[model samples]
Target: MSVELTPGLILILGALPVPLLWGRVRSIYLLALPVLAFALMLDTPNGVFGQLELFGLQLTTARVDGLSRFFGYAFVVAALLGAIYALHLKDTVQHVAGLVYAGSALGAVFAGDLLTLFLFWELISLASVFLIWASRTPQAYRAGMRYLVVQIGSGLLLLLGLLLHFHETGSLAFGHIGLESPGGVLIFFAFGIKCAFPLLHNWLQDAYPEGTVTGTVLLSAFTTKVAVYALARGYAGTELLVPIGAVMTAFPIFYAVIENDLRRVLAYSLNNQLGFMVVGIGIGTELAMNGAVAHAFADIVFKALLFMAMGAVLFRVGTVKGSELGGLYKSMPWTTGFCIVGAASISAFPLFSGFVTKSMVMSAAMEQDRFWVWIVLLFASAGVFHHAGIKIPYFAFFGHDSGKRCREAPLNMLIAMGLAAALCIGIGSLPEFFYALLPFQSEYHPYSPDHVTAQVQLLFWSALAFAILMRTGIYPPELLSTNLDFDWFYRRLGRSAAGAVGRFAARIWQAFAGAAAAQTSRIVEKLGSHYGSGGIPARMTQTSSMVFWTTVLLAAYLLLSYF
Candidate 1:
């Protein structure tokens, strides 16, 4: 490849001329850009590119390696699929934002230096929020703003970390930044915020569901995974991720169970899925890292598949609320089929994409004798299958009919769903295909007898419990209510706290102003008596007052001499 050519930059630059094109030419150009990027990525040899000196420091703009290549492939694939899904629209801004967002993420993943990574990282945050704002609703606009603040805050943390890191290490290379120093800790949390680590996670759940139907597909694909890649690259085997990952896997499943919005349910499920990858990265073995990368790969395809199916429903019926949607299968059978495939894939059902990948993390946990953590992961798995697999489909496609009929998804949407569905099956049926793209080599098999049997039993019992609860009418019915998450603190208390702070500040300013005004009024009153037209200074301008003052001064001087 030419020295001037960067796989990600090509896509970023390719977006520049999109507004100038018209009709078929533009659509073709949009579709070809990602494909062209994929070609460029494939052509990138395993070496550095665009190395330069900046402020007397070596900056690597491009670093093509096994890990970067895998993520690059995933990012472009998602971009291609998302572009095709969005092809029916004539909105240039969404199209351009999608390309730029994907390109920026790709660039960050391949960055060899912290500076290069930070630049792309900030660009990605700016670019992706446009996808959220593309919905053009007050809610979407608000969510996009919230999303931008959190994302930009994360970028700021990264900048601070990088500056301190450069000072401490005298190098800006982005590699093996364990949380042993102040700077590394800052960088870790920066990545952690993006990775949706527990309480810091509300931004993903908030912003993604508000995205435009097509935009959510793009939103779902890149941001968190790039953070995951960063973790895998920097903080592997840090030990802290063990409990963090366990909690991530466990807590979100409960929130998912009660979520009213199907898209939000998927958001929680997305959190649950990341837990497995985090665990694998914590394990930090060859097999474990492979598991993390492999699971991330499958997660993107399946999650995009789920998001696409939900996006299709949103496009057709105008809402993805579980309470509003039911019996969609009768109107949109193909989309229903695609949604189920994604549901199964995410649930880690036998012969699904998730089965081959998630188990590696759990298995790695067991190998390290983390038996209790393994147990928690097991329960989380069962919980995931229940909510994401059963609830999403049962509510959206097969529940009580809501007496609504709509046309099938548009052809382009259908094609995109079909493509993602195909990937879901392809990776599940042949795990080796996805496994080949992992960062490390391992001999873990996902289909052993014990593994299959244990998974089956866990799923069976979970399904049985779900049925019993439903039969007894004890399961929580879908309600038109927003359940509070960590965002509640911000949306409610944080806003209140902010208001209180503002009010207190205002009162302090008012009190200060009042005292100053009172003092000034006192001064003005004294000055007015002394210097007003009828007062002494005003009268002293006359000849009689001047002579009286001069005579008084001479008398006082003569009295002092006599004394």
Candidate 2:
């Protein structure tokens, strides 16, 4: 197959000339690229294409299976939505980077082998860093560098694992890569890193909030979703993911609660939501996998919607810090409504996107008789409602008035948010359309009496708890202070350790130089005393003495040469 015909390649190659175009034409082109790519993807028949022989091994460049097609659709829609969101921007650099990053993610989703996946995987890091750097702030620059390093590290681990897997199994086909070998373990960690697993997740929170408003929306959409898809494709049914997913879902709630930056809160929320998909994938059943994919698809829209709302706030108000924002609904009513929609969706409100999808994972856990996992997930569900569902909109739009007013978000941004908000409600109210796109056929329903009652009760109680905490002054106030997270090991503690090591090394070098200087001085004084004008050699004025010295020197030279 021609490489240009590939769905991802279209967006990538199409983005190169965006700078040459101007104004409305550029916007149309930018939006059309993703739509065109999506059309091509839809037209491409299922099964493998773009086969090639490399080093006597066959490589499949494109695999349009049910799984890949589902993720591909999600990526394309995200790209289109992101393009619409960013249409108000004039920065061609961000434009190019966003498109290429989206295309790279699509490429990875369609990749048929580990080698092919690695190519697009590294490209994703390379292209996406530009989104962070497009912010052109000192913070964004540093954050982008860190994000690049972590992403590249993931690629390196994937490369190493694939090499080992190829050696052990003589194949690099990306299938159920269980952790039964060293290679499989490495690959699992690679996917985990991209998935923002536990301690490895600070990059998302650190770099995402620092991106350009539009850039962050794109960032929120692609990278982690690709990781979730990869895990679903390769590591589903792995028992360990159950516990790992539980931790992923549960731990972020604490940090998000105290986080002053609303965007960072969403970043943490993104991690929490990923945990649900991870749990579904871990179950490895048809219904479970369906739940995972359904949730992933739903999440991309609502998460992007949340990011877009925050981005609009940042674009107009100059900051998204919870301490610095309040009563925004008075000015940005559209943005406020969209943000609330996103919050409700993420919180699993009865008529929202998360309600339909997140329950699938929880139901899957319950069906498997995983009592502890179910409990943890339930706790996480309530916790997310407290932080993301209630806290985000409450603080940004209705909390203590910051006495700041701003114009509404741009029309383009509002349209993008409206589209995303509609998708969230649509998926929730009419889940059949969404569920039909899943990889597997499942009869699981999302609107059961017990399910609705339990979810509503959970949300109601969680909201009530937040209300009491606020009224009683028990909730952590959003203050202008740095909240320490796992990144402290590198950002603070790690920097301090590095400084200490550097200072110690400098002292050691100083001592060694001092000792060497003293030894050299002593040797110099001795040589000066012996070879000075008043020394023995200077006193040896007689010809016989000189000849005797010359003969001795000649003899020594001859003896050393002979040896």
Candidate 3:
């Protein structure tokens, strides 16, 4: 309780000695950082601390309130889970990067000023990229680079917007910054990029699957959630986000349904889930805000569980492609069961985490008369069940037998997944305790007859539809082929277009150079004809001609001077 340091610093600083410590000492040290941070987070009271003034501007580095407190708890818990999940690895880079990344996210959450937020915001990207690169594959390398560019670009946009906002308003406070000014709009897009806004979301799917197995789990828990927290803090009630979030929710279902890579499917699913939170933030009502925050917390748990499950498959069988995986339950029964739990949670099954949290946003939309938004969310919910709820578990664990036999996930991974599954069930089964931690007070019930009945029916019909599609051979088959998304515009199409233009430009340059070279050669030849060893100037009369010309020039100068 007497600890003066914020929890974020504790984790970040504690990671310093990780590389030097080895064996059980290192593992203990790694696990203790998160535990200590969590304890410090819980002990810290609600208030602002670590205020400073620089260049005549006030800054609050640590702001503890309901919103920050909620995110902080989730982030710290994620770090602890990640640490446990990664405990068996000898990869110190991952451990350090994961800790620092989680700490940076917490730093961003607690930041009370835009400047402080920006500082932590950029650090998150720098630290998390190592997770992707840790895979040590060329594909992972390229993905990490692209992911870094987008993430750092987001930070730069945030920085530029905050600076402009400071100049216009003479304040850097992190509060409602609706899209009324250029600065606010820039800031909005910056948050949108991180939130996986429609056209700006390719990075999430592109990079997350490329990370090391445990790395992907850590990556899933931080960046977007912090972006969500930032949006809730600064851009809440911005109506434009409603439609944007709706688009986010709807489109990824199409991609996820056909995505061959199971991890990539989850990545798309992550984008879909974020849409619910984004919609809640956009609604800006107390209930909507509560829904957004609550869903984020639940999502961190369930999503991680799902990713951990797939990660385990990737670990044991060396692949997560649905086309190549089946009958895995016999080998990894615990993992299979956990993956199903995750699927149910994400699909919003009654009495699951997603059901309890996601419904709040839908209810808020309905209350706000956002008829279309509510409808799209409903469709998205079903679509998620179709792909994520059934597809992930079915193909990976129960579909056509791939005859791939392997050991279950490591003890650490099983422990981590079990804890996450427990949290999902716990939060869903006992809503009051989790609801109490929400930013706003609410009496909303997630288990009322209407809510329960509708959710169950939606899930049931979604599952039935999936069965019919599979039975009738109408479902999209998972194939080991690339599925293009918005990134194709830049990654393939844009690159090709640029290459064409570059070639055209290069051809024009070559033509010009050739013509210039030809002309220069002609000029040089002509000069050689006149002035070379065999030319007139080289002949015996050259000295006389030169002297005559000099005499004529002298005579003309003398005549002009006399005149």
lDDT of each: 0.91, 0.92, 0.92
Residue lDDT tens for model 3, 56-115: 989988889999999999998889888999999999899999989999999999998999
Ten-residue stretch with the least lDDT total in model 3: 1-10
Clashes of 3: 0
Query: Model 2: how far is 50 from its true place, Å?
Result: 0.9
Off by over 4 Å in 3: 1-5, 508-563
CA lDDT for candidate 3: 0.92
- CA lDDT for candidate 2: 0.92
lDDT of 1 by residue, 442-508 (tens): 8878888988898889888999999999989999999898999999998899999999999999999
Worst 10 residues of 1 by lDDT: 1-10
Worst 10 residues of 2 by lDDT: 1-10
- Model 2 off-target regions past 4 Å? 1-5, 511-563
lDDT, model 3, position 358 = 94
**Model 1 misplacement above 4 A:** 523-563
> Which scores better on TM-score, 1 or 3?
1
